[model samples]
Target chain A: MLSIVKRILGQMKNDKRSLGLLLFAPLLVLTLLFFILSDSSYVPKLAVYDMSEKFVAELENHATVSEETEKPEAADYLEDNEIDALIWSDSAGTHIELLEKNSKSAVALEAIQDTNKALQPTQKELIIDYVYESTGDNQLDSLSFVFLGVISFFFVFILSGMSFVRERFGQTLERMLMTPIRRIDVIGGYTLGYGLLAAVQSVVIILYAVYVLQLQVEGSVALCTLVMILMAFSAVSVGALVSIFANNELQLVQFIPVIIIPQIFFSGLIPIDTIPFGLGNLCYLTPIYYGCTALEMIMIQGKGVVEIWPWLAGSVVFIGVLFLANVTALKKYRRL
Target chain B: MKIEVCEVNKSFKQQQVLNQISLTIAGGRIFCLLGASGSGKTTLLRIMMGAIPADGGSVTVGGIAVPNRQLLAEMGYMPQNEALYEELSAWENLKFFAGLQRQSRKTFAADAEALLEIVDMAACKNKLIRDCSGGMKKRISLAVALIHKPKLLVLDEPTVGVDPVLRRKIWLYLRQLRNEGTTIVVTTHVMDEVTQCDDAALLRNGHIIARDTVKNLIAQTPDGNIEELFFIDNQSEAEAPLC
Candidate 1:
């Protein structure tokens, strides 16, 4: 038993990557999450074309509001702007026009109405209209919008990571090292093989989320599926790279809490912008964060690819780096 | 293709695995590397296969350095452990490996089927390796290694877990491969396995103690068996222990 323990520790001591993973993966995840989910108030942004001085003061107390001049051009300011809603005030009551309808916008509109209701003892009704024209018919699944992207990233990451670890433990990778197969080609082949399954999976998930669950996807079905596929591909690359550092399946599973779970918080499932200011930047570190953010932009917010190009570009870069890291990790087995 | 391992030295931190080992692997014959578990057989084979770097010295095959990927396609290497995916069927394993070896399925499908039949694994070609017994996995691994019809076959303890009958069949297949002008290098701890090889090298404690034909080796030992040589060496080493 002593010798057995010694041998296991001896093997682990030499494997610097596994040691680093054991010591730091969890710490990293916890640190990021602690900062992200820390106590902080989120202030919503609201703009008014023309409003009563009393109403503006009441709204400013609860949100970040701008008192713009009552120009006709300010109506167009509500289009694709950061202002959650346009609060129009007249003699009758307070009416709000929403540019987009999502959890964030919905919450913002509700807060505005609640604040306006308290302010006006005379006016009783709050009128809410949408620029994109929401029928207010369906009960939208808000979390699944981000969950759809996050889960796809999560599953693909695990599958690809486990498969690579299995290949190593079974000696299949060692056999490949013996053959004439170029290391990059091995990575490419795995990415494509898993990428194919991931692509199909993403489409099925999108269809299920959109048509079956009626999850309120507002983007092009085809483009949303393609973005999901790209996210899956990025996940595959990440999985391959991460699995290289793990020695076995159990060790690979250890990566889930560190790599997969934290991305849920960062992936906009809980509204990343609401997580306060400093921690919001850390979302860029996770690939799933880009995918989830992009999905939210395209699906719930009805933005096109051009709007989410930075997130898309960031995910592409993540995949590229992971692909290189995977190829380099194979160098431990065979120099070629 | 000829492999020349020149004064190869390897160490794992403090424990030396190979000690200035050198050997000339002649082409077109069956060569057996007989040694016990820790006698550096796998390490030496890995060096010859160009899968790992040597601490000192070098190995060259067909006049190129150990790890020339272009020349590696001509060599089929099967490590001590059976290197097949348990989740995949025998056919899938063969197809994936052959594809990685850059052989088109359309071109090598018949050859792969013939190789499977040779290993007597045709019946379970579609069954997952996880369901197969230990011996079946070894046989499937053998079939995969030969899928590309490599010119130089390097095997490390390829017959470790195989049954006697199947082992006999595999030896015959190796003999056939050697006769077809494929240079074969096989490592085994079993003394009897060396008798069938054209040439043999005995290693103990990371040193090649002897290298000769079966006839010459048997003639040199009193009991006319290589195991006698192994026992004599072990007995002497015990009487006068190394510092």
Candidate 2:
């Protein structure tokens, strides 16, 4: 196992492309998402017609408020997306027409509601609290924890899968098996090798997400990093296990849809209960789901290791099962 | 160790690959298995290496049954394909396999250098296998198999992509290893390469058509042409020219 680990590290040392893909690819995507997901830079355009001066003044602080003489014209502006939303008062409360399909609609609605609450003063402020509340300033800030788990697992999965496929196709696997090394050693060695790099990768990425990208972490950052490292080990084992069914790199890639995409979908990206039927239960089977769930508990809910050990155990069980499966799969190549 | 394969049988799905095949190879000699493509040469080699199980019969290296991990420690094998770590340099690849064979790092450092020299790849020892030419990769792979100086060396089509000059050098190295009591089994379709071996087995379909010493086999064929032995019937498919 140590020899295989040494070989993996040696190969990785010489493979600049794989190293670059494994280390920097997730960072690049997250950085791009950092800029795109943060809503602080966006200023919503609001068109007001027949609204009181006090409410418009408060709304002005939250948005770029435009005054209009005609309600139809303001509605037309919202239709054309010239304004994110239009506000007017009639007999039945105040009407706010928001442009559909524009992401700016939610921002506009939140700004209007805040402005209304501020101006009314006595209109009771709803102090609703959740069991687990989002602490991020924006959606991405909260989702960044999940991204850290998903992205790290994604890249590691691809790297390990492609590398294993290369070994099989290049026949290096056959050569390795020809040695006196136990089949389990090959699986263990890969897990350790890639798992070591995954630990480093998790540290760098979690630190980058927490310190560099300023992703809010309410719980211990070390706990989150541990979860990510486990996810990566699971990714390595899963990748090797998946590669057994693949004949080439392209076939390995073809598995991404079947093996990876489902995991991403079920990794709490889309609300599981919202999914039709009991398909959401499939999330329990994906390693990334447990990883993302554990990371969410740590970074967002401020939950510690005690609260998340089951999730971590889920990843551990994944690694163990897949490791055995990989060992058994090698029976097709060499038995013993 | 004396390698023995007794009445081995192997099949894939409905198609049979090896059928009632048996052969004995004594230690300290170069034995060659000669056959055309798909003639079960690779399958036979794989079964001998304990890579794949035989449906019937048995293979034993020395006195131990096949697939014994400790027994494999005394054997080195080179598959037909260049099964090497392309991302690693030749030296690094050697170090990895040598480490698996449990060769101490200090001893491997010297043994690797000498093996690289034998394969005439000392200068390119640090070159990555992917960057090396086909012939260079073959030489490095050959070096990798010899890195541990195993008691039994199994090579499958080791000289396919190697240049003639380097081929002669590798043959000489095998003979030298044989003299040092290494049992070597090589499989190749190349007829002239058979002359380098002490004994040759001609496999047709899944059966051994002939097995004899190089001189005796050549003496049996008319015109001293080994190709004539394989071409006794015109109905045989067109084959790569055999010298």
Candidate 3:
């Protein structure tokens, strides 16, 4: 056991790049998440022209509403980027016209809704015109969580698996085996090393998505971290276990589509109901299904630990079973 | 009192790699298992090292049966391939293997350095194995195998790709180990190396066709050299058994 620690430390000392990836990759990724989530603020500018003094006051309260003198000039004001929406009051009640520019229609629609509420009981109809989404409403934040889960699983799986497989093909595994070290020691060392690496990666990616990317993390960050760590554990174990079947590094990479893609399909990235019954149950069998589902529940739906524990539990079980399989597979060289 | 094998037979599916073969090697003796490729010489060595079990036979090392862990602990094995980690420096590789043997840090540090010196690779101990020459890698592998200073040493064609000068040096080291009560088992197809063995076993098609001292085998075959004796034995095997 002491030897395993020494060996792991020796290996880490020798491979600076892997060590760096293991220690700082999560921090780098988390920093990226911070920047992406926190940088954007929605403070849409608005201009009101020919509005009743009461309506103008309401608009000014909700947004940066400027009073314009002319209707024709209101269009000019919107084009000049002075406001995101325009309101013109006439005999047909207070007609709210939204400006179209390098602005989001959802933001414009939201502004219109707020204006209508502020002018309630006045019977003013809110007019919303979007340059885009004229056919149907589109969600900008849709599927961002799913995409995040996919990217996180991919990087964790490939990097972890490739590193483990290289140790085998490079004959480092055989050299280590020649020692009096137990089989469990090798498995434990790799699991702890890569497990720690994947945990940090998950934290970085999740934190970046929430705080940096500004993706709506409606649930607790602690729960998200828990799910990420579980998912990483599953991924690292699966990666290392699958590595045993691979004869070379290229063979290890070839497993990505087979091993990783199925998880994306089953992990709630796609609607499970849309899949055929036989195939839908296959998703239940994949670790990613549980991981992504838990992530989505926490990050998108704001669900807590009690709601997502089953999925988390399933992922933990998968990791444990795969770890055992990895240890068993190594018995081909030395039994017991 | 070193190694004993009785009627060992091994087969891979329909093909037999080791026929009924038996031999005993005394402690502190250099025994060379001589054979061409596919002669099952390596199989015999592997069985003795407890790397593989014989299909039908018993191998006893010291007094215990083959495949015993305790016996294996006392044996140093150098595979045909230089199985050192390519990414690690020679010193690091030695340190890892020595640690596996449960050797203390201070004890193995000096032993590893001494073995490196013996292999004439002390200067390049810190260099990664991938950056080393083929001969240097082989020498380093030998150093690692001997790091634990096992009582019995098994080398599988340790001098295959080595130059003559280095090969001679390796043989000298084997002899030195043998003189120090370390029973050495080596496999070779090089006929000249056969003469240096205290006893030689000529294996062909998994059968021990000849087992005796090199001088006795040469005397019986009317050839002063092992190369001639090898050819004579192969020619006789090609012909039918005389009535």
Candidate 4:
């Protein structure tokens, strides 16, 4: 029984990457979840209509507030937005329009009621206007925002890892090494071949998300697509490097958590700012972290490439390191 | 185009795979490394091809101490495993390997076609290797080994899964290549396969127990059979435990 177990483990030992992922993926994911769920405070954006300047100033101090005197514009703001509540003053009393299904809406309403209670005996009253009209949940935006990145990483990672695994299993990789071909030819050939495939995948996915899914991208579509392409290229390199340590196609798929899943946690949906010192900065080490960041910056934050250049450069550096690592790794199989 | 191994010693962890193994292979001749599994035949071949390094000593191909990049151009190696891409047709596999050496498909197209015909795989050259039989894969693997037209052909178990008919055809093809002045090194355990070579080294547990012509090896044995000679060599080693 001991020998049988040893034999099984010995087979696993040949695939060091799978073992590393088996140990490291859970630790990284736990770290991300601990930081993300720890913060519970909900801050609301308040839109006040025809309210007193004093009340607006006081409300601004407690929650994010925008004073709007225009009647139609204030009504539209109540109909569509991140607005937690809309405050208006009429002859009957003060009215508070609350965006329903928003947890912060209750918080916004309570702050106004508290202020009104403090001003008792001033012949004033407060009423709640619950807006049932859905402005479309921001939660979907948050989900889709990170979802684009996760999907891009998912497809490219699998394709590239399998491609390299096929090269090894077919023995064509060994044959290629036996030829007069240089190490650069082997690595560069794979990069060019799969890199083009990844580019096509990126183009289709990004275009479909933008045009078909109608996911709003604030920045230039060309630039957003460029970010995803760079992400795909880096993902391909990661797959190749990981492929060197995997023994089979099954071992290759085990890298999904180590390569793609962790990025979803550190993505903007989770508050990276609330994360503690050293662990927060550690998220920057993952290549997909940069991808998710750059995507969020373009699609949601309305930023150009100039603002996200540092993150994209980080991705290029990752690709360069993985390329060098893959070339050096071939030495283990052949002296040349 | 001469290949020589001198004092080649290799070890895997605590076990010695090859110890001071040496042989001289003449150009335009069929030489065989005759040994059973674990006798280090494959290790010795890999070292001479510069695919792996020996723990001690050196290998020279055409008077150039090997593990040299430029020298690799003249060396062709077919490993024990089937090395062709399953998804690709035989023609595509041949074209790719040939393109590695000459970098032009058109330049080596005729050479590849001729090699396929010699291996009796011309009719199925356009079929995907995934759909080919075990013998056909081995045949195309041989065709790929010769695709570059290297001066030295180092083949490890070239006829392992081949049928008897294809095996005979392979021996004839190896002889033809030998006549055309290509130095071929074939490794196998079957005693009859060694008879086709000009010179053969019978290895036992990382040592060359005997190196001689087929007739001389047979004449030296009391029973006068190649199989009996192999036992005589094995019994002597089995009696001396220190080796």
Best by DockQ: 2
Of the candidates numbered 1 and 2, which has the greater DockQ value?
Answer: 2
Query: Given candidate 4, what's the lDDT at residue B197?
Result: 87
Candidate 2's displacement at residue A286, Å, is 2.0
Give the clashing residue pairs of candidate 2, or none.
none
Instruction: Looking at model 2, give its docking quality level.
Output: medium
Q: What is candidate 2's DockQ?
A: 0.75
TM-score of 1: 0.75
Per-residue lDDT of candidate 3, residues A1-336 (tens digit): 555545555665677787677545654654454445442557667776776787667666666767767575556666777567776767778665655534454565576677668668677676886432212111313455566666667777777788778776654565555555677777877777767667777777666666754656667987877777887777778888888888888998898889987877876657998987567988767888887888778766778988988888888888888888888987765553
What lDDT score goes with residue A261 in model 4?
Answer: 69
If the candidates were sorted by their TM-score against the true structure, best first, what order would they fall in? 2, 4, 1, 3
lDDT of each: 0.77, 0.86, 0.74, 0.74
lDDT of 1 by residue, A48-72 (tens): 7678888788877788888767644
Interface RMSD of 1: 10.0
Question: What C-alpha lDDT, on a 0 to 100 scale, does residue B92 get in candidate 4?
Answer: 75
lDDT, candidate 2, A15-109, per-residue tens: 88888877888899999888888776678998889999999899999999999897676446776757888899999989988768557788899
Give RMSD to native, each candidate.
13.7, 4.0, 8.5, 12.6
Q: What is the lDDT of residue A26 in candidate 2?
A: 87
Q: What ranges in model 2 sit over 4 Å off?
A: A46-81, A86-102, A111-122, A131-136, A271-276, B234-243
Deviation in Å, model 1, residue A269 alpha carbon: 3.5
Which residue pairs in model 4 clash with each other?
none
Instruction: Kindly indicate the candidate among 1 and 4 with the higher lDDT.
Output: 1
